[model samples]
Target: MSPLPTDAPILPLSQTVSAQRPGDAPALVAALERCRAEDGAFAYSAGREIGTFRIEARTLNELAQRLAGVTAVAAVALETGPIAIQPCWTPGRLAEAEHRLGSADGGTGDFAVVRLRIVPRRSGEGNIFETEFAGPPEIDALNAAVARGVARASAEGVEGEGRIIDTRVVFIDGAFHPKRSTPAGFEEAAIAAMRAACRTAGLRRLEPLMEIEIMAERDHVLPVVNDLATRGGSELRRRLAQKGVAIAAELPLRAFLTYEGDLAALTQARAKIIGEPQLARWAEVRRR
Candidate 1:
């Protein structure tokens, strides 16, 4: 996920899917489908896919506030109990709450940090949000940064080790010394650490992914087929399969800016972007 744009309004982004009660996504998905057939006016990317993340929080408001920073968090909603928070918040206050976001499932093994990334949603300002939680420096910095951002508007949060931490990186042990320059271990470590730092910094992952539908004239089918055959740099999860050939792909909001329009152009302007990508066993289930 990219950093929040300096000029654009922050859109809601997230990586917290489990935040919703079990089965909530499926129920919501079914409901949206019904609405589409009956109303035919569902906003594209409305039904967002949810990614599960852990955050340590005593109340929902604390979670919501920090989430507002990562650039991904949308309007915070309560999953199990009523969510209570102030209508408005500041960057400084959110920083202190950095450590508050822990996985509802796992609390980073006593480590105060977690790995995370911000994902943009389909609607609103398209700001980025947090995803996942790891440990150590990333978690530490994120926790500190969030408070700092919030402090820019509210209270002074705990200051983290301002300098970049090296432990933040991870190495995918290539079995036994093989090839390449350590496989970007430093970069990977930094990302994991950065994400953790974001979570700690108060950026909550809201599990926001985009759902795109492509429709093109019959004559344009050939190009569409060709693109589908060769489009490989990214991961595309096709959510719906229209036997008639109108293709639908559940694209991760994490990387849409790169080719969002390009994909549509290929469809001959006949594309119809649907709701947000919802989390599932398989992001998209398509038949050939």
Candidate 2:
């Protein structure tokens, strides 16, 4: 199983199912039919006779629990999706973060002047890595070294809370002795400078928002709406349905994690809720 994209909208719960043996297709299909009968909300499409089957569910946990009893199934895997990370930065917050790393021979050291900033990119704009340093030393090696440094810092993170996501690391200025400059020295310097810059610039955490719809009886709708409000839901709209009322709203994913159980308890197991991740927005830092 994998986490879905934080910004994805209306992502249905999907899983891939495979049989244990080549001849188990018939058994697998029968077992899957049983699962589908038990929960009419999900549907599956046939694959190659011996290939995997794809299933989508409104409630994955319930479906998975039922699938666990299907002896013909060998494995079930959830479809993966994109992850989101937004780090806020400003020029005022960024300083020329500098670092010096001495050569192995103890010669004059390499000094790296790096400017790291979180220039927020439009969705899908990607990241930028630029170098303006001119050198007798190979520029490609220096660039590679700088890249390694940035990658290491990104993976390690500024304070270990979360890895640095999308950000720009520029080698705007630096000094490298022709004789003492080495890729290793420049790499170390870049890493140190990147971390220093991140610490100085600070970080802002953003959490994903989800669009959700809840179905509850007329008498239970008000209580459900109130509960959603307490969980930071917004833009609530309601409409009459044949069986009940449907309420639609946007809510932070964190607050919505336990909503299913809470909805059951609140409506005496008579309410149904489903959601899809929408966009992300700046939020107060909280542990996941």
Strongest candidate by TM-score: 2
Error of 1 at 211 (Å): 4.8
- What is the C-alpha lDDT profile of model 1 across 1-288, one tens digit per residue? 323222321222322323355545554444334543654322112212343332222223434543333213222332422222111111111221122222334333222222333222232332333324334443434433432332222111112211111111111121111122132332233334344444454421222234455555555655755564453222343333453345554443333434457767666556544444332211211223
Kindly provide the TM-score of model 1 when superposed on the true structure, using C-alpha atoms.
0.23
Q: Give the clashing residue pairs of candidate 2, or none.
A: none
Best candidate (score: lDDT): 2
Q: What is the C-alpha lDDT of each candidate?
A: 0.32, 0.58
For model 2, residues 1-288, the per-residue Cα lDDT tens digits are 111112212223445566555576667777778866776544564433336665544344644664465543434332222221323222224445777665444545554444444343333333456677766647668767877776666654434323454455667777666566667877787888877776667654544456788888999987887777777676458888897988887666666667779889988999988555444432343432
In candidate 2 the C-alpha lDDT for residue 267 amounts to 89
Model 2, residue 144: distance off in Å is: 2.7
After superposition of all CA atoms, the RMSD between model 1 and the true structure is 19.2
Q: Which stretches of candidate 1 lie over 4 Å from their true place?
A: 1-211, 228-244, 252-255, 279-288
RMSD of 2: 11.7
